[model samples]
Target chain A: MERKLQERKVNNIVCRCEEVTEQEIRDAIRKFNLTTVDEVKRLTRAGMGLCQGRTCGSLMEKILSEEINKKVSELLPLKKRPPVRPIKIKLLAKKERESE
Target chain B: MNKTADVTVVGGGVIGCSIAYYLAKKGADVIVVEKNKGPSFGASGTNQGACPLQLFEPPVLELARQSLKLYKNLSEEIGYDIEYDNVGALVCSVDEKQYSDMKKHVEKKKKQGINVRLIEREELLKLEPTLGENVVVGVEEWESCGVNPFKVNYGFACAARRLGARFLFSTEVGKIEKDKDKVTSVATDKGKIITNFLVNAAGAWSPQIGKMLGLVIPVKPRRGQIIVTEPTPLNKRWRCISDADYLLTTAFDLKATEVSKDKRIKLGVAGVYLQESTGNWTIGSSRDFADYNTNVTMQTIRYIAKRAIKFIPKLKDVSCIRTFAGLRPFCYVDGLPILSKVDNPQNFVIATGHAGEGITLAPITGKLISELIVENKTSLPIDAFSFSRFKNAYLQNLG
Candidate 1:
């Protein structure tokens, strides 16, 4: 996966599960005024596409804290919703439709 | 290190979680204490996610309108898909009386800036052909929308947690420690935590929590049951459908015992139907003041199914997968939601009593509460939902 990421030609892939690159994260930071892992996840879908941030959360936070010139604790973590594992949208939709 | 916080929010439901999220975002040291292990453990987890403007008066309409605007960006902002679909809603009128009443109601709502119009039976059928033949007229609100309630609750909670908000789940607030008409700390089943401010968003249990402070909230539990159908094909164009009389069942004076008995006789069953993205249809619901009993009865479920079938005859063949019940925290004082700070308690804020619209009004509730705590005032005028509105009732109950 690391070799494949280096060979991607355009940039260094940081989050292998989400195929997110360091350049993309930096671009999202500048473009969206992102200062935390949470903001990066929302704008670039860096830690949300796959792995639910298990692989790239710390990396993203380190990059964010460095970019914002803030301590690690100052930057917020990525927000996580239920069903951390991938579930079919059909099931979630079915559950949400009902008014119980 | 002791677990001290700037604000301690009671209840892990949507309202509490949203308030916590906004407060944390505003840089307040927040702690949420919930008896349940996670958020949306109450009525916030249940109910169809309808945010219709026509169903509310001025006070609620203002909040609902603002919340709708916030929901448009909530999914993106929170890094979660709340599935907010602005499909609109239809209020079907089955008789002449209902038709005229609906017409007047639409006019009133229109005056309040709601984008609603009265449609003829032909137009209504054109919009939703599956509607029953008894429907004479319909009032359609084009701006109405639905969302995933659970996602909304969890989204707010997760965002709040990410922003350094501490969540103490499965820790019941056994006692409230106050100092001379001011909130000082909260004693939970796990341990005692000190706090500067307190927020009561305990859904059905808000009144019970208020008893610890000698406050009367006038909120009660209204039990509403719903039924979920299997993956059945529904018209994507069709919006949420509702019988015109759903609001009448939530009257303050109507006791649950009396309404439950009369509903069995006349069965003034109004159907509320919404199709999910999964090709399943959710139909409901029956309301009564069941006093925190969140049990789904076979009788009520059967009645809801029959009534839904009356609205859309196509649902007659769909098999119901399951049934569930949720308790709506209905406040009896002027039928408005309570969102105010008590006079006696210096740092105590009450943000419950939203009833059925809790899901719809949560965003504004959070914004208002955070603004009150952080800025010492609210951007929105919350005079109508003031705690003083129920002061007379609270005094009478005390007597």
Candidate 2:
């Protein structure tokens, strides 16, 4: 019998944007021994979505910070890039061809 | 290392990841934050992967077109196989009423400069012989495409990271500490992180994110239920099929539960999406009033499975193994998303309400958002999707 499956560990929200529960994030964090938020993002999409981290990033940082007893700034905010939304492949191709 | 990014993105969904990818490709110091293990786990992960430019609303259609083009070569550019399938889409009609509706829909689709065509039973059968014998006519858009939603999200995330972008996961925002209308810094569950600008990609959580800045982003959850069957030996060239009215899968009727107890009655062809690699065919989805919860109901599973089997009897041997649901964040009335700046506080840039199209509109949405933050010039015209449009009714009464 899968005892872990049978165990009723109550679920809680650790990341609200994606609706990822605390037990789940904690499990990943503990299992992975994650340190930075970026590692957590790769492991889990906790801060990804529309509200972005406007609502949940700090809370997750706190959860991890409290668990490890570190300042949030030590972890640092995540990075950003270009093409903030979905786009056309043809546009990219056109630009590529133009450059060549 | 006290490094500051050109911009800070809150969500790691396809929308957020795409934006990050673009900025990084342009040599912008980009940061993305995710709450789950990775991007595409929420609405981005669960919705259909239709990149259909033919069916989108006008302005959105333009964005969809650009997104479609990006998707065509994203696999090569992003260095990942997103499982793009331009095998075409079919809308099988069961009755004359639907046939007539489809005829009109096809006519309009052509007038809109789309390449959709109507096919009779013979052509439909030639296209998909395993289709139920009853399927009479179908609307086929040969150029329409489908993608792996999870892969799309992952591709953007991975591509963004490769381009010198950083992402923070398993972290939550505690407060948007603001100075007057300008955001000074963001406090996390751990500590404070300062930034020059904030992009709201919280999906269903957009409303709460706005509340932090004394702004109101009207976003709510529209739930969709899905059922998956055991893998079958389905061909790769096969297309995704649905009813012309398959779009109505979002609305659920709790009263119909009694009728479904006895016989398999398909309300409409609402749920339709497929995985090109997996034989586990996904079928009939319901749009329910249920909020943020990811619970699976037997009633919904039965109705969807039964209708899918009815549409294609080959499913009898392929027993259903799992049923799941996802939430789409939508703006109440305006079909457009909230992708504009807000008043009162300047640190927040809103980007929500992509609805079921988040997977499709992601790339363009991210592009436009980055332009707004970095160069302050949107590559595409998005006047119809501005956040200030709701000022008359919503922003005035924000909680």
Query: Which candidate ranks first by lDDT, i.e. highest?
Result: 1
lDDT of each: 0.77, 0.68
lDDT, residue B314, model 1: 72
lDDT per residue for candidate 2 within A1-100, as digits (tens), equals: 4666445332666567466776777765675456656546545656654344556777778777866678887765654322234222222112223332
For residues B1-399, write the lDDT of model 2, one tens digit per residue: 333556778887878888888878877888787777566667886666766555575777788888888888989998987888785676667565677777887887788777888888787777676677777678777666888777788778878888888888776777877777787677766556677788889888778778877776767887776755545677534557775445322222324422453333332225464634445566656655467877765555555655665557666565444455778787775646888877657657888888768888888887888788777878898888888788776645664
Off by over 4 Å in 1: A1-100, B248-269, B394-399
Q: Model 1, range A17-100, lDDT digits (tens) per residue?
A: 557888788776765445557657644556654366778898899878877788888765665443345433233223233463
Instruction: Give one digit per residue, the lDDT tens place, for model 1 in B11-45.
Output: 98989999999999999999999887566668987
Stretches off by above 4 angstroms in model 2 are A1-100, B1-3, B235-237, B248-269, B273-275, B395-399
Best by DockQ: 1
Residue B225 CA error for candidate 1 (Å)? 0.3
Best by TM-score: 1
